[model samples]
Target: MYLTAVASLRAGHADDVFLLKRPGWVRDTLKQLDEAKRLSGGELFVARWMSGVVRAQVPGLFGERAAAMQDLVWCLAHADKAPNLGWMREVYFHLAALHRQRGEDAAARRYQTLSGFASETRPATFTTPFSEAPVAGHTFSSRLIREVVPGAVYLLSGFEFTEYYFVVSADRRELIAIDAGTRADAARAAHEALRARVPSLPPLTTVLVTHAHWDHVGGQRYFRSLSPSPRFIGRGNYKDELAHDAMANPAGLQLFFGKEFQLADVLSYKPDVTVDRPTELIIRGTRFELLPTRGGETDDACR
Candidate 1:
């Protein structure tokens, strides 16, 4: 499909190219085109595309024709039909024109001779290698640190679940925590630790959720009881979204239910914090760049 798309684009099929959305839709087509190239008497669409670019390569290949001639002859000879040969001839002509422009008539003549020889030669089969062996799995460990890079901090509460949070500044010298702790104690401890480090302990700020998952958004209510109580950052119709997701995905709902129960059992609070959308606060001096991406692991994912 990629070759087909490339061909279409080269042939001025802009609308077709636009509709295909290269990365998403054209991958399958490109694979098909590759398969066709492998078959003895299949489509030469990709070759046609290559021929256009190849033909246009002559001026650039002025002193390099002798080196490129073999590949050119191969492209011309190793295709199954007349149109393919015709495409090769068109490419040859373009290269010839380029050679003429560069005053290399002898080199042009040499390419013309090779093109004629291509008519006498036949298409040869091509093959690629494949591996069927399974690969081995690997594992690695990550370290825990408190407030390593300002907004980004690693809070470890004895390995059950080590969480990281990106702190966003809140109104009236308060802060909002993004991706709070796994348990209530972890969340409150993290808040206190951050406060102690910053010397602004009381009047704790809000807590936000990256997604509805237990691990990422586990400390929701714990931090929500601050003086200005933290608010959960979610979509416009978050409740509806959450309900739809829970119903549609039973396994996902089960995962959240267990975490929610655990969080509720161990919940602790500081002060009250209000919640609202468009929470445009600087996170520990690092500004978050929001980019839309496919979200499966978290409610919101940054690509």
Candidate 2:
């Protein structure tokens, strides 16, 4: 099962893995393993293997980066099970890349070599084009620019992810919530702050997710559950990638948000609004033009 799961992940059939899990495979497996433990003298490693098989197929389906990352770490940390060396190598190489981006050359090199992802196979070694900092904790509105367009445009820079864009109509009634802070706590805090600043503004009619990483989408669940729930939007391809990452890793809770948060914590909120192609929407009178972009951080992004 573990090997099958790995093949599915590499083959890009992550959705199937989640379908099996939604029915409660993990809980069922745990029960069976508990019975096995009672009958046998020792805890069996087979249970671990079975779980990894299902997990390795799509680690990121948990819909959060911290969750995806922790799962990747768990897979690598487990030595006793009949592990998937390739999956371990891929995750380690990815971690090495993350470390190099953060300027941890020593740690980067360590992971690269340990995973057998040598410098020769790829382009330059230790080249992380993205920011290394743990994504900035704060954000502010960019200078307002009066353009030919119908609505006002605001730039959001110095963020943990790429810059953010928030557009509001000339009339204060219509409003749309753009990117929130990265990490669940940061995102949640930012949303609350935005609310406190503008007390009379209408409820958020729409939320546009630029991409589907934790930093970008962490507050999405929180925002979606508001009283007059806002319509959430994302590139159409967004869900599959997010889902794949969650199932394969299932470690996002630990790696990104810290270990206290877990899968059960995130399932409470899933994306209610998803869009495949670049689209536009008018929320409470404010209009937004969402353009899709692809780059170093995610396969699909909204600009």
**Which candidate leads in lDDT?**
2
TM-score of each: 0.35, 0.41
lDDT of each: 0.43, 0.50
Which candidate's TM-score is highest? Answer: 2
Per-residue error for 130 in candidate 2, Å, reads 15
Per-residue lDDT over 126-157 for candidate 1, one digit per residue giving the tens place of the 0 to 100 score: 22111111120010112233565454343433
Q: For model 1, what is the C-alpha lDDT against the true structure?
A: 0.43
Full-model lDDT, candidate 2: 0.50
- The sequence of per-residue lDDT tens digits that candidate 2 reaches over residues 196-290 is 54455455666677766655665555565577877767766765556644664545334444433334333333455655556776664655677
Cα error, residue 249 of model 2, in Å, equals 5.2
Error of 1 at 242 (Å): 3.2
